[model samples]
Target: MSSSEPDRAVPDPRRWKALALLCVAMFVVNLDAQIVLLAIPSIEQDLGFTSGSEQWVLSAYLLTFGGLLMLGGRMADLLGRRRMFFIGTTMFLLASVLCGLAWTGEVLIAARTLQGASAAVMAPTALSILVTTFDEGSERNKALGIWSGIAGFGATAALLVGGPINDLLGWEWIFFLNVPIALILLGLGPVLLRESRGERRNAFDIAGAITVTLALVLLVYAVVEAPDAGWLSAQTLGLIAASIVVFAIFAWVETRSAAPLVPLRIFRNGTLVGGNIVMLLLGMIGFGMGLLVSLYAQQVLGYSALIFGLGMAVMTVMTVFGSAVGQALVTRVGFKPVAAGAMTLLGIGCLLLSRISPDGSYLGDILIPLLVFGPGLGGCYVAATIASQTGVAADEAGLASGINSAGFQIGGALGVAICSTVAASVTGAATGTVAINDGFRAAFIACVVFAVLGLAVALLLRANRPAASPAAPAAEDVPAPRTGAPVHAQAGE
Candidate 1:
């Protein structure tokens, strides 16, 4: 067998089953994030949640999920990916059930937090499994394309489905829907998924994990609160300052720790760093657009939830299509152009969206951008994900996947906070339809800026052919000192 090939022969039936289960899991987790957006109004009405507290339902989940992702990946490595996967799936199912049964906003928020944490554990491990199960090259690309597609497409699909489901059934059913899917995946997991673990000797970096988690949580909290508290508020300043301190400590800990939770050396590679930068930017632009667009559709356009969902459906379909196409072409053309082109398209789409006015129609104004933006985002996602994991070793795949996923989740939180702040600031003192359009335009312009930045980062990636196998290290890798400095050591130095 080739070096990149799996040691064991392909278990055809089992592999297909495993892929199906993983896809279902991906769909459920993503659906949870977006479905709630459409149902938020209903949830508030039913649970009597205050306006300020309602955002926590989504924020709490994102906070815990994003905060613990590195740790979850580390746990998967130490404990075993399959074990962690099963545990995560079970926890997610239980949390979904609790969310469905939640009577108060507090309980729903808590359940969502649990759901997010469990999702963090599951998401990275799923990618790791795909890497291990499929041989590198076409097979792996196809699997990853599907995986990435599910994550993006699921969110948009949730919006489409959530409105109808909530209207026909109830807000509870939005979560209850996960129960059946989770059960199916749980049943298939043991039989289809093989047992896998990372390098056994590396110790888990508990201190590094804790510090990083605290840093991200504090940072996200500060940003999220800035809109309500004002930028100059002491509470916001204190949280932001504390986050900076914690992150500095995290960097220090990673450098010295024998088994760093995040190996600082990984960032030294231009490809990895550049890829993650683009991913972060793409996340900010893409997610921010989704939030603002949804708000505009309902608030300004005066569209029903169902109509709003339908209007966004084109973006979802195109995203899936683009992912499929990008996966097929990435090996042939390489990641640089694909990423750069995608960002360019995304920038154009956002600029077009910025042109929207009170007289704009869904088909003419929204649909055009959705079409362009979906494909652009899909290309960026595939290229960035592949680039991040390109040279990662088998044992380190889980950690690499975790870091990439973290960039995306953190980007969403950051984007939402920043975009919301900008929109609020622009529209705060204004009134009526003009104010709404101004807020939307401000957010879209921000998206355009983010997209352009992503394109610039993508251009920094070297024009090199992608490797045929996971075993082949990315061209970006170079031998260096443990301190991440380029050096040549003597035998006895």
Candidate 2:
């Protein structure tokens, strides 16, 4: 950077090691987001939480995580990626400790909110680091494939592990499990993670951040509680309307601010936008399906948490294969076809799942659809990871990554709300279990619709990378030997 400074002779071979460290953190965060599925009943009973308050344990985390991701990402760009990583990991660690020790439902909810905020900072920064470190061809593809594979399976891993941990110790152990992992990452992160930041700098858009956060909180709360509140009730409608108004204000603020939290120009890229939309669709179906299927397993089939986890694990193994194959195929056929075809397969899987009967066996009902959908979901994630990170400049890497990940987080909450509400829409005097079964079927039907819509969007997307200002293609740096031709677009196809 200076005349006296000598250029380094050796490339950093430790980059991949850093990625592995980042994945450790991400696994814990993603796991925390979903592992509570099995523990919810235990938590409600132990902490004396009402049904209403119990649901908030999950919603609060989603609200903060989805709402603050852009802000966290922008801060990472401004403050330095490594710095943000440490801070985020520390916050997450502290929150996990508190969650494990929580004596009240309110305290647990508060701790979860902090954990979500910490995840918001860490997850995008981790992705940005990977984007900046790896080239966009086979090398980047390989790394992203692994990263996407981890993401697609992290929740299932949690589900599988949650049962054993909860049964052996308690639900608190689920949160506590993050402690050692967090400390280890914090210890290694400074040494392993290289520092990078945007070439440009500007004042923090605090107003935009607050506006968007408030909007998201309102939106998430309204959606999560809408099933019980009556979706058409004035309370639900009012919150939804208010959230829209706040979001409009945030969008306006972004346009006017010299340093916007979310750069609107990124949306112009059809491939990236399509990737994000599909990511949202995945998020929606993923969380919603988990809730429905797990409920059906536990309530209807009387499966234990361990059984639920193991069932999902079978699917996770298939997911790994899907992602591995997807990474290979994207280099050959491009992300567009992989994304569309994979999403269509998932849609069909959802359709198949909708036919599940109350008396269905695991092999016929659960295993069939899980086998059908696992690889599809894995392929979708791999395609999305590549597409989302493909066209962005180094400076805006965190922002782009945040938005893509945000789609999943926000979509999950909205999906759960909608599906849960729909599933619960049975008439009076119906058995509770019957209502739940009906609800799951409805949720699967909704997933089918969303998956179909995602397939359409993916099919319509362009494969060429959108032009990014201030920097060149990320793939240009590595110069890996081309197998046949350049895989995805670089500024132009």
Candidate 3:
């Protein structure tokens, strides 16, 4: 059988159990992204982080994680999904330990970089494994719904628990918490996951991988540091220019490589392209909103960290409910309509949140918007993901998974930078409560703009259609990666 074919005729019975394990793994990845936000002050005091440099603690992780995701995904496809996942989980565990044990700011930042690198390996590989595990129709859609909901919940859950954890324990426990979870994943993974990989090509795309990785790292670094460096400063402009040049070089390398890291023709899949666009907009809103809300609650409203987290608890609950509903709706209707509806809700939520007053209470201003927003967030994740994966070949599943993740992460960096810059512009050396609240309100309005753009893109997505079978084409008919149509990678034959 071709490597693109599913190895099993009947689905694995352990798939559901495996899905639970994968979700747990995904939870940790999502949690780490925002848990540190609440603990930044404690971490700074403890580690003696310089005023400006403390941001590196977060940037360090985001940089490496976003940079290497594509390489990580392709490696999983080439090396073995299960093997890469195990390696990533073990590495993450060690990095978490290192993070907990660090006495210096530099050491913690180094450990965070390691943590991000490992996450780069884990996220896409886990999703690729999921793509391979379930049947691609309603079964996969259902599993993705559960997965997307938990994934959304993981981010908010960090907000829910991060403050309490930091207040009761220390910031170290935030990293250390991954210890038991990682150990559990390491133990359960081997038994639960079946090994799988794509066909091994004769030559590895070393140039393509290196160039693309460098390009992504530079891109992330540019946006992340733009707010501090001054968006129009030479440093920011230089890095952005350099990133574009390197990306151009990577494209050139792909066209010439014997085995390109990302086959250029993958762009031919219109659904995948449209889905990623929407996902990018979603990412802009998701992380940006979290940061803005946290800032408004604690910095403006004068709520304690623990209290703020507790106030946001409804977001987590509603996101879970939304995921379940969105998944069910997608199965019945289609991803396009569901995605459009979700974006509409998100836009409405943002509009409501854009009107927050300086003296606003959580019950009066924040809670309603979160209630309106959470389901849309949950549903949009599922819809966009399903859309991105549609028509992708099983052999390229890891690559597609990586692209989907990269879209969100890179978009998050951009979103946060844009929102932060906008807020800073509005606040402009003003520390007053009204000034800060105005900044927060303006940021929410920015989020509303993202939602509207996302909705427009969602409308443009191709209708949901069954993917073509890879086996339909003879070996000789398979076109070269650079020049031909995609070889649809249906999960089960």
Candidate 4:
């Protein structure tokens, strides 16, 4: 009998309970990320944050979240996912308290950074737990499908709730709300979730982690600052140069290290590389759309936070529908076609969004495109996730999952920075709503370009098939040698 078969045959109510717990945790994480958008005006009013500082409120969280995700994933494998999950949840809950109590812009930004780091650890480990618990079949697919669906819906739901919460209670309530949810999850997680550990003993690559994190931070800073500071400014040029050097060092270290943070060999697999590329594009497009559309709704269309949230809620409902359809199609039609088709639809949606004007109504200007883009992005997210892990060895699953999560997190930071820079440059301190609308139109055009690129990359992905590996003995096979003892002491190898 297959090793997984034994686990599958066991009637474990804990598995279903675990899935529910994780899904709620995921909803809270995603909600926090988007809920801030509705409360941005309130925050600015209370904290006196300038437009430039406002951007940092979002970017700081993203920077830390994206930069630390790979490290977080490796830590989960080394320490134990459930252990890491608890630790991360505790940190996140504490951070939320700090954010709610923050009196200054600096304090809020710092708190946001901590919140993002906690999210990085929690997000991937939740998915990893799901994968480890469920056998690869209908059950696994269904679990993942619900997970993906919640992710798709959570952003919009945040916007929907954010406005009312901020309006009725205060902006602080948005952060305060997470405390109860996290406490509940923390209470239940230990009892319901099973512990799993990676089989390989690898040393954590501290140097690689430092170099890569620095490189990404510098690169993103350069991209985001280039529009404000001239592209040829000394600061921008220096940061860009430093980024290249750091990345080169990271590559060299990974190749030579006995235990690398990110195994260089993983990229040699076509599916893994392709999936990461697709995920990057998906993040660039999907996140870019959210940032631009929210701005358009409030700044251009003269909508209140409440109305803007309502519009976003419409999009979230559609995204849930899209995830359902994508899950149904993946089994019968395969991943490649679904991904490619989704990208095409996403591009078409972006093209339509580019036509919005200052006078445009939500129904005419936003609703249709959001309906189309919702499903397209939803399908792409699932396909890229599945593709990333399709053939990964059990020992490398944590690392693979980390890279996948990092791709989206990093891509989001890059996308928001790039799109914001472009829009800011085009708008240029314009006071009129019409000028802001024009800037949003330009941003939408940029989103269309990204969607086209994503479509091209999606087409390059091969159809899903059984993976062949010399290292893969069989589903029931045990490791030839025990590596767990080494892993406990030296992580990220």
Candidate 5:
């Protein structure tokens, strides 16, 4: 029997319970990414963070989260998904408490960094567990759809709850909010989750792991600092070069290692490759646009943080709606069409947003574009996720999940940097509101380009499509490994 056959034949009765637990884990991860934004003002005031240093509140989290994800994912595959999940959740719980108790800016930044590292471990491992638990067909699609919707809620929840929490309680509550969620995960994890790991290897690729992680850390750090330091500044260029050199070394190390941290061969899976590429673009467009919109609504249009968040609630609702529709469409038609259509919508939305005036109202300027963009955001995320994991071996699921998550995280950092740089370049020496509006317009145009590029790449999924089979492949049905990657399909090829 194939390794995966038994899983199909005797599905776990607790799969749904496990899924619910895993979704909570994802919600926490996604929530942290945005929740801090709303609380930044309060955190700065209480912690005495200077204007320049305040950004570390967000940067510290993104840096650790993006840098360590690959290592965390690999650890999940080797150490045990359940074990990693438990460990990560424990760390996250502790970090949250530390953040809430922090007396200074430095302490809070340090705690946020730890929180990001723990999330890196939890995000991919939880996803790997979900992928393994559900059969890769309609059932899996449905699970992913729900997962996407919850993730949307988590992202929006920051806006929905963050303002009130900051106003009523304090910035500390933002971190404290995670305490209950993490405790629940830790308490219920053993009862709901099963232990699983990848194939045993004689030697762990310690060198490869270290080098790749260093490379990613450098890359994320460079991008996060680029907007302020100047893209071509000596520091930014030096860091970028260092990252490239380390990555090259990692590639060389992978080629020579018997049991590589990430098998070079895994990149042969075309669907995984294409899906990650699209995911990167989605992250870039989504995050870049989000930052610009916040600036436009609050800085230019004179809206309160709480009110702006409430206005954005519609976008969140539409994102959930889009995720469900995308899931259903992918199950019937295929991921390519669904993905392409999503990018098209995003492009249109960006085009609309680019035309926003300095005196624009939320209803006239923002809500209309968001109405079109939210579904696209929801659909693209779901489709790319399903596409990325379509035909992976059960053992490597953790690795795949990590790679997918990393793409989005890193892409978001890059997108923000690029968009901010563009905006700054256009707004140089201009103190006028109209000049700032011009910068925002340029940033939206950049997002439009990202969407267009995503559309182009989504089309390539058709080249080596994997035929959909009703059942998991048997031992005899498993095909020989191919030199090139396959564009795996969940529906008819």
Candidate 6:
């Protein structure tokens, strides 16, 4: 038996209970994401944030979240998962406290930055613990399905609850609400979750960690600032150039390091790389749609922020619907076709929404596209996560999860920047509905391009997944690696 089989042999009955707690952690993170989104205008008014400075309130969190995720994932592997989870929650709670107490725009932005950093540590480790505890096959698959479904709810819960919370208790409650939940998790975590870590390696990859993290930060910052600063300006051009240099140095360090933070060899898996690529695009699609649609609804259609949140709830609900059916579709039709179809649906949905008019109502303009986008939105996330995690070894579970998570986090920053930049570029000397809708149309066109590219890449995931690995059992004749990454339906291959 392989080294990983022993972990499976001694099952932890408390694993399910642990999952419930982990889900709560995930729930709070997802909830926090949406709460502020709807409340941004209110937050800006209260804190005196100008429109230009206001974007930072959103981008700051994303910057830290994306930059630190790889490091966070590695830390989870080095430290214990339970320990990391606790630390993460505590930091998140403190950040929330600061955000609630914040009297200035600067403070609020800083608090949000800390919150993202905290979540970066907490988020991937939860899934690592799940993967470590559960065995592969229907059992692990089912757990992932449930996890995805809960994640969908966590993401959309803010839409359902955020509008009311912001209205009734004030915008501060969005952050304050996390206090009780975190304290409860802190109290119960030690008893509920098991401590798991990879074998301690000889030396920490300090150079590798620093360089890669710097590159990610630079990249994220470059995109975030490009819109306001002019994409071709020296500042934007220099930042992009520097990020490439720093990333190249990190790659060099990884190749030479005795123990790399990101294993250079892991990139050898085409499925892993492709899956992460698709994930990045998924990030663009998901975040881009949320921001653009919300803008059109409020600015063009004259809906209230609260009403818009509730309307967005419609999309979130559809996502849950898709995730529920995603696994079954993958099982029956295979990941490639399901994922391709899902992206196609997303593309078509974005294309349809680009037809919005000044006189359009929510039911007429927004509902159809959101409803069409819902299932694919729900299904693709789970599919991408599965595809990314397929061949990864037990030890690298956190790493895989972090990269997958980073794709979305970083994708958000890119999406906002790209959409904003594209939309803004066309608004010169133009005013009123024509200017704004012009930007929206241009941005949606970019989203459609991204969706199509993602669909094409999804096609590659099936072909690139190899038919054999040495560790794969000869008796069972699994086409993909049993211990490493595998095609979901490789049995037929």
Query: Tens digits of per-residue lDDT for model 5 on 1-493?
Result: 5544444566667778888999999998988887788788888988999888989999899999999999999988887788899999999999999999999999999999999999999999998888877777888877877887777667666676777777778888889999999999988888888777776677899999999999999999999999999999999999999999999999999999998999888999889999999999998998888888988887789887778878888888888899999989888887888889999999999999999998889888998999999999999988888889888877788899999889888998999999999999998989878999999999999999999999999988754323354333112112334632221211111
| 484: Cα error in model 5, Å | 32
Name the regions of candidate 5 deviating beyond 4 angstroms. Answer: 1-7, 463-493
Estimate candidate 1's alpha-carbon lDDT, on a 0 to 1 scale: 0.79
Tens digits of per-residue lDDT for model 6, 1-493? 5544543455567768878888788888767765677788788899999767887777888889888888888888776666788899999999999999999999999999999899889888887877766765455655666677677677667666777778778999989999999998898888777666665677899999899899999999998898888899999999999999999999999999988899988878777788788888988887887788878877878887777777777778888888878867665565677678889999999999888877788888889998988888778877777677667776777788788888877887788789888888876668898678878888888889889999999988864322222122101112435565322211111
Model 2 per-residue lDDT tens digits across residues 234-253? 99999999999999998999
Show where candidate 2 strays beyond 4 Å: 1-11, 200-202, 432-435, 464-493
Specify the highest-TM-score model's number: 3
**Candidate 4 — what's its lDDT?**
0.77
TM-score of 1: 0.91
lDDT of 3 by residue, 15-74 (tens): 899999999999999899888989999999999998789988888888898899999999
TM-score of each: 0.91, 0.91, 0.93, 0.90, 0.93, 0.91
- Top-lDDT candidate index: 3
lDDT of 1 by residue, 1-493 (tens): 4432332333344566677778778777767766788788888999999868888878888887777777777777667777888899999999999999998999999999999999899888777776666656666667777777877787668778888888889989988998998888778777777666665544778899899889978887786677788778999999999999999999999999998878887677677777778878877887788888888888877887888887778998988888887777777788899899889989999899998887667987788999898888787888888788776666666777777777887788778877898888898888887798888899899998898888888988968856674452111123544655322111111
lDDT of 6: 0.79
lDDT of 4 at 481: 32
Clashes of each: 0, 1, 2, 8, 3, 3
Model 2 scores a C-alpha lDDT of: 0.79
Candidate 2 residue pairs in backbone clash: 423-439
Cα TM-score of candidate 4: 0.90
Selected candidate, larger TM-score, 3 vs 6: 3
Task: For residues 336-446, write the lDDT of model 4, one tens digit per residue.
Answer: 787788888888898899899888999999999988888887788777777776666655566677788888877776677678877887888877988888888888889
Q: Which residue pairs collide in model 5, if any? A: 268-485, 270-485, 270-486
